[model samples]
Target: MSSVKYSTRVNSFALGKGKKLPTGNEPILELIALAGTVPGLTSLELNYPEHFKHDSLEDIKEAIEKAGLDVPALQLRWPSPRFSNGAFTNADAEIRAEAVQMVTEAIDLCASFGADHVLLWPAHDGYEYPLQMDYTKSWVWMVQGLQAVADHNPAIRVSIEYKPADPRGRTILNTTGAVMNLISDTNRANVGVTLDFGHLLMARENPAQSAAMCLQAGKLFGLQLNDSHGVADDGLMVGSIHLAETIELAYYLIREGYAGTYYFDTDPVRENPVEECGMNIVRMGAIIEMARLLVRNHPNLPTGRALDSAPILWETVMGGKWNTTVSV
Candidate 1:
């Protein structure tokens, strides 16, 4: 079997204190060079406005090319102060328009790079308290804004990477189902969902089941792979905490033949970025291998009762005693 392709966050190479920059780290070009040094890294996932803050689009593209890395994806990062209220869901129409324009720009750039799609995290598109947001109006605005961008360019895809909550206490499009609903409301072929593993865990979702849902809908456009503690977007290394879930997710993606790149959306604050990414690749490869083993051993594993399936799965994954007579 061919080895799986991998990509990583460019910002992970940036060395700086939290929210503070200029920590004597390399610039984008040098950072791209460093990322290229990573063994298994094949592509680079960049941010639109954030990456553009210092370098021009042409410069960024040239750097990636020089690094021998392809830009498979670009994420939109709306500044907090300006978009604290919201992006597409902002009450201010002007701010909302600006956010939409940023997304469109990212889409156009993504097309230029021959990338897969542009991702919208919408970090600010959420709520903090009850009555803090006009749910109906915000929902309509989000749908219309996303539709406008999807309609703007039919050649490229626009993916929504939903998070349970982060800059706010409660976020819109917090779950895979919610993202599916948004895609349905948008009603665009090019619109899809970016299934983030950490985000799914934060929402207390089963990553494999969520992948199945997206795959069933044919809307699984992108993947941001990482592990979490089921409470926050921890951005831990893949398979670090929830090994079984990650393995199951890999099984579905492999068995169902997902053709998208796996971007390591991790934050390695204390560890070396290159080493952290390399470890992620190793762990993910192991998870995929385990999943492949399960497929080879138990092709119809989940078709039967859970009680019967537990021993097979446990033995297949752990290679140890799984008491078949144990009562659950």
Candidate 2:
């Protein structure tokens, strides 16, 4: 069987929605330990700045090692109230400088892993209302800031994730096209786009198509998996909704030689986050395994013959080709 390297966001474990923000070493340490226990979960996509600042890099590394897992990516969540107005794209020069410096520091932290990537979610770097901001200036600052961050250490990967409006009425990197444009403007090899399946669905873009675009552009740095109703980034279990899209995306990744870790960016508010996360791993694995089988037997994948053989693929995935694919 082809290899599938699985990883998940540690913050999902500490989602604790109704409770106080889960902070500091203990919670994260617990998350690391929990991640290590999930079957097929080999690594973790960690929260940057927050995790790095809470514990010394040395200590954090030790914690991960102790948990028997590795860090594959660092998600730069740039939407704190401090960055509510903006972070890298902020009008304030000082804040923009601070954001750049933060990326530099985050890159430094990733250096210890030799070549790990960082996930950049510019969640708040957009406007909520019309005519309340200067688009041209903010766009320039955002791109230039990104280029600076990418140049900090060309070897370290910067995977910029795009999402439709949420905390902010409209996010700058809200679509695959916009993200591709940003990648073009940055003109840096190390900078790439991270297409989150749920987010893509939220944006009404075909996840499979976006994945292909990123692959063709040589900027598909990584990916995040989770399912939603396509209205919000609910971070539900992968394939829970949009089953065909999820299956197609899995097929595309495997068929196109994507070797990066399949990261799960989920939110488990009141549910048992640990169990919920583990379920995501199993569900995503099933989809990917189905894709592998489809490829082994029919390789064109999501196009041409594969498109014509959709019914068979669905049958195999939903019914009997493998025990993992139980008819539901």
Candidate 3:
């Protein structure tokens, strides 16, 4: 099997551009230019806040062209009133409508930039107290809001990212199961799931298992590549933890014929952005290399049933020493 290509979220490199830079220079373009220089990078992911301020879609498109990179995906993380602070699942109908409008605008922007997908992480749209909110009402609100966005732009794909509570409390769609349920309820062809490996680790879901489940459900629209300490969403370099599991997950993707972009969704808040991103790229390349070796070494590896029972197969291949030591 050939190596899986990788992409980087521009937010991961914004801090490295220097703190004194003006906002108008467009950091997303700068990050794309950087990633374009990376040998195996096939695309780039741009978050909303970095490029949403551009006056027109043509400007954003021009920046991407100038950077020599394509925007494979776009994320809506800002315009705080619409996304953050529980606007999508707010109790008020007007608030929900506004949130839908914000996302619709984002979808339009995605179309303009030729982005393949739009990512929505409903992190803040959840309850902080048990009895303070109504579960049924919140689900209804979220579905309605998301439907509005989907209906507005059927051409662009929208992916809901699942993240368990951490810097916050009880996100609505905190698990892969919950996200799957949302996709079933919404029943939109253009709406799917964004599997973030770190978030799955934080949720205590086996990353390989989660990937298999999403693949089975036909909801795996995109992937966020990052490593975690199995506790918090560390966003460290790939293969930092769960080394064998990461390799197995890559094998699964290869078996399932997943052709979507693999995005590195780490944070640059606490570390040197460029250095960390470069390390992440190198680690990911190594992981892909290992996956290729696994496939080559096990020429007759299972398909269907054998692939479904991959945990046992993987354990047998590793001689039950998959977790014996940490790599990083």
Candidate 4:
């Protein structure tokens, strides 16, 4: 609506949850092909290992090209069967080294694909109960492991994706602030974050405010757009549940200089993945339209040297809803 185009990316596996409903098991090439059919999808965030059918990068690259998409980033899911316990901050030194090696290898793979970023989600890197592990040692090992990965190559951006808790009760690097701390400890400019909206909702952080804060800290490197009930990660379509929050998030993102794509992480379990993803793009566009309308009607909402109050923002957003007599 503002004449500003917002590009979109979909995680390769996200396109066909029905193929393995509630979870995804679609083949890499098929997923790529299906996602490409989605009108607005510009790129993909691939999960390493799973998404790689064979060692032949050419095979995958050719398939992706044939599908009409680009590989912008790769997600390094640390809780795979190979990394059952954890990756970055695993207690065992040997396992930790393997984890670091995996990340470095993924970075090289990303380079091969001409992708600029790698998403590191440490899904199982924390303990479920108290006294089950030594917090100090784990945190130290985690920091060192991350540093090792960051030090591998300064050219490739390593974006850490944080979750409050899911695969682990007390997931390491679980919050935005905690992730920011880890980025600080990593001491690499290329090390930033992939802020997932569903994870933010589960963490009880205002997605809009979190985007603003993370952008301010210069740590918001990537974004995953999805929705949840705030109770669990439903992976519902983006605008299905949290309309206001999603719109506000778009407002902040558009207000800031978010030039990256909104990577779709939705679970289209009973729906057509291609149709659902296209719908997600359209939904995000509607939200962006709301943001555009709010700013258009109340021009002062975003024109300031400092952040506006929450009430001011909510009021402006609420004001966008109107019933005209002509409509009746």
lDDT of 1 by residue, 40-141 (tens): 788998877777767777888888988888887888888879999899999999999999898888888888899758888888899988899998999999
lDDT of each: 0.85, 0.80, 0.74, 0.76
* Residue 202 C-alpha lDDT in model 1: 89
Better of 2 and 4 by lDDT: 2
User: What TM-score number comes out for model 4?
Assistant: 0.86
Evaluate residue 256 in candidate 3 and report its C-alpha lDDT on the 0 to 100 scale: 75
Question: Tens-digit lDDT track for model 4 on 64-112?
Answer: 8997778788888664676767776666789899899989989999998
Q: Show where candidate 2 strays beyond 4 Å.
A: 16-26, 300-307, 320-328
Winner of 3 and 4 under TM-score: 4
What's the lDDT of the predicted structure labeled candidate 4? 0.76
Q: Considering every candidate listed, which one attains the maximal TM-score?
A: 1
RMSD (CA, Å), candidate 4 to true, equals 4.2
Prediction 1 TM-score vs. true? 0.92
For model 3, the local distance difference test gives 0.74
- By lDDT rank, best first, the candidates go 1, 2, 4, 3
* Cα displacement (Å) at residue 280, model 3: 2.3
CA lDDT of 25 in candidate 2? Answer: 48
Q: Every model's Cα RMSD, please?
A: 2.6, 3.9, 5.1, 4.2
For model 1, the superposed segments whose C-alpha errors exceed 4 Å read: 1-3, 15-26, 320-328
lDDT tens per residue, model 3, 220-301: 9999988878788877778787787788888777677677887887766656766777777777776665666667666666
